[model samples]
Target: MNDADKKRLLREMIFYRRFEDRTFEAYMERKIGGFLHLYSGQEAVATGVLEKAVVGQGNKNDYVITGYRDHVHALKTGAPAKEVMAELYGKETGSSRGRGGSMHIFDPTQNFMGGYALVGQPFPLAAGLAMGCKHKKTNQIAICFLGDGANNQGTFHETMNMAKIWNLPVLFVCENNGYAIGTHIDRSTAVRDQYKRVAAYDMEASQHDGMDIDIVMEAAEKAIDFVRSGKGPYFLEFMTYRFRGHSMSDAKSYRTREEELEWEKRDPINIYSKRLIDAGLITQDDIKAMEREIDENMENEIIKFAEESPEPRVEDLTKYVLDDNPDPRWIGPLQK
Candidate 1:
């Protein structure tokens, strides 16, 4: 890649890392409520994949959806940091108007479908979106992000079958962070290599180092290109780790401190920063400047926006709860 592209990627990765760190701090301070999931150690996966999937020329029509650990993805997919932070703060100015909380951020303008809380729900939803694009004869594709544990869901296999048979344009990304909540991948999954499972449906599939942004970008570009060319679905397994617990409340007793430290040694941001400096693409001063900029934005801009934003009023609680005009047949007894 060119120096410009490398610098752009580095800047974005750093922004996401800093943003996540600040978010965790906010959660700890009880500024943001509900279950909080931090995308701390797995920055490279989202940064690399999204750099190709959602940005630049020829990517305007793409759609993105992911599992609940979604703050970083929402931001990278073009949702403003202020709006995302507001969403976490349960402010009415949030992406979902404070209704979805941390997990269910949606911004249709950016074509970020949502951050679904259900384990593997995004799989079929992504396939449906792809099918819509196919029927409309648009080159648009859907990128579905799921966790390693979600791979075990029945919806995963069902979506794979439907996507292959119908030749839907979709990319199924499994961010395998080793553990699913308290359970490890070895114990939860029958086949350790998640990508190999895609072979059952005869779809294109591969694995890549999720810790390296460049490798992920390379793999993602190939997979996205194949899918956009109307070659059906592609499966990508990103082997990564989460530095924090599954959620803010997790004790993480299942893993050892040694294992955690070992992965920390391979910190994606530190490694990529070192690589950039060594290659003369960026200097220490450049890194420091970027860090300072991100910190200022988080403190002066994003947090203040959220804190000053209004909360949804109780009287208007049912406003966005249901559709304004729905088919009477589809409306259940509860609505009636």
Candidate 2:
């Protein structure tokens, strides 16, 4: 990578970290609601993989789908930060036009597909997308992002089998953060390492350190190349950790502070920032300036956009509903 790319990635990682932090504050202040999952520590996985997937693949977009922890993925896949923030605020200017808050961030024009609220939902949806591409003979592939717990879902195994049988061009990424909503993987998952589980389907797979952007990039470059080369599906497990609890409501009493602190030492933003500084690509002052700029943008642009955006009007609530042939019983009567 060039000096410029390194510096840009460093800035992006820092921006993502601050973005999640600000999101936590917004949730606390009641500016946002619903199941708020912050991508605080897992920035590198999304940053590295999404950025690398499009590199040298020309300007075409690869379809991306993920679970509820999706703000960062959406942003990386070309969803604007202001629109994401507005989505969280449930305003009319949101990516989903205020219909789906936090969980369902859909922007298909950018090929980000959508984030699913149901556990393991994206697994089959991604495979189906790949199947469509294969039928159409398009070079485009589907990228599926799911959590460690999601690996146990029946869809995970089902999709793996079908992808291999049909030779679908899909990449399944398991963000193994060591816990399934406070339950450690060791306790719930019999096979701890997620990549090893894909062997049941004879699929190619690997694991990598998700905290380091460079490592994640190197791993994703190979996986994405193999999948896009028409070699069928590839599975990658990123051993990452989320800094916050599963959701805004989670107290996280299940984990120890000592363990959290240990993971904090490997914080993705800090690691990337230090790497950029040590390589002389950027100075500590430059990093601070980057943070200041991001913070200001979050407050001035993103927050202002969400705050100033109009709330969805009550009369417009049924606009997107299936009213073309609506059932009278399900629809009932609207309030006057």
* Model 2 ranges with Cα > 4 A deviation: 55-59, 323-336
Could you list the CA RMSD of all candidates, in the order they appear? 2.8, 4.1
With a 3 Å backbone cut-off (N, CA, C), the pairs that clash in candidate 2 are none
Candidate 1's displacement at residue 23, Å, is 1.2
Span of ten consecutive residues with least summed lDDT in model 2: 51-60
Error of 2 at 318 (Å): 1.3
TM-scores of the candidates are 0.94, 0.94
**Residue by residue across 264-303, what tens digits does model 2's lDDT show?**
9999989988887787888888888888999999999999
Write down the lDDT that model 2 would get: 0.89
lDDT of each: 0.89, 0.89
